[model samples]
Target: MRFKDKVALVTGGKNGMGKAVAMRLLEEGAYVAVGDIDELNIERYLSDFASKKDRFIFVKLDVTNNDSIRKCVGNVIDSFGKIDILINCAGIMGPVKPTWEITENEWDQLMNIHLKGTFLCCKEVISYMIKQSYGKIVNVSSVSAKEGNPNFSAYSAAKAGIIAFTKSLAKEVATKNINVNCISPALIETRFLMEMSEEQKAVLLNKIPMGRVGKTEEVAALIAFLVSDEANFITAQCYDISGGRSVY
Candidate 1:
């Protein structure tokens, strides 16, 4: 129970790596509030954890909107009394095309979710964390950030921005006992990956020295450690879990 008595807010907690991180935190004894827009998945999550309803909540969230973010954070504070850990896992794979071919709307939407969303959430939650003099934050980045993926200009740029954002926030709150970090994972086995074509999948697979994509549980474990007291000394770092795809 590394997170016993703690309260965690996980964005995008209804699916993929976000959902896995939420489950991991809950299993470790934290009161968790998941902020997501997926009502279907929210319903499923509630049913799955009906017995632990007291410790869990699902708030409809649209990270791109400041008003929505404020409401979601407010709901979490109302229910949990405080926010201790925040996982900014909300994101989307933007247009997979050449920079010249990507539309302006596509670019803006991608930036809104991946980069601006992380910034907004951190901005709203950091004050609460500073007030308590303690917090842990993990932003989910992508391997594409470090080693830019072809035909993924917007995603690469936005994810790279997340890394810089995490570092800046970590330093700002360093003396406040808050640790802010990020993770860059390569293609993981998720619905996102399933949506890719077989040719695309094989191409991505060949990039991993481990010969397999990462698992959500594996990413969850890394995040669990980062947010726990065990990682008190760690901050402003980006941990890469890319099946050996990225080594620096």
Candidate 2:
């Protein structure tokens, strides 16, 4: 029970890695608030994990909307009194195309959700954290952010921004006992990877020297550690979980 009595908020936790993280936290004795635009997916967790229903709540959220984020945070605080951990996981892979081929709207959409959404969530929660003088934030970044891909310019840029934001924010709040860090994964075999084209998939796989895709559980485990008191001495770092593909 690593997170006994603590409350955690996770965005985009319908399926894939987000759900895995949620379940891990719950098993470790944390109350989790699940937020997603897909009401059905978010609610599915309640019914599917009925045994742990007491540890979970669902909120309909569009992270890009400030009002929506504010209310979502409010709802979490109302339910659990305080938020001990914030996981910025709600993001989408932008249009798969070259930089020039990507539309301005697509670029804006990626930035809005991944970058701006992180900002909004943190802005609303930071006050609560500051008051408590304790907090943990883990933003999900991508290896694509570190090593540029062919057709994911918008997505890569947004994720890269998350890394930078995590470091900067962590530094600002270190003296206050709040830690911020990010995990950059390569290919975690989530639904997003299934959505890739054959050519794109091959290109990505070839980049990985390990010759295999990563698992959601692996990322979840790392995330669990990052939020634990054991990681209190760690902050402002982007750990690469890309199966040795990110060797610089």
Which number leads on lDDT? 1
Q: List the residue pairs that clash in candidate 2.
A: none
Give candidate 1 regions above 4 Å deviation: none
TM-score of each: 0.98, 0.97
Tell me the tens digit of each residue's lDDT in model 2 across 1-248: 99999999999888788889998999999999988888754445678668888888889899999999989999999988999999989999879977888888999999999999998988888889999999999999999999888788899999999999999999999999999999999998799987898888889999888998999899999999999999999999999998899964
Pick by TM-score: which candidate is best? 1
lDDT of each: 0.93, 0.91
How much does each candidate deviate from the true structure in C-alpha RMSD? 0.9, 1.1
Give a tens-digit lDDT track for model 1, residues 1-248.
Answer: 99999999999988889989988988999999999878974566688768778899999999999999999999999998999999999988878879999999999999999999999999999999999999999999999999988889999999999999999989989999999999999999888886777887898889999999899999999999999999999999999999999996
Backbone clash numbers for all candidates listed: 0, 0
**Alpha-carbon deviation at 12 in model 2, angstroms:** 0.9
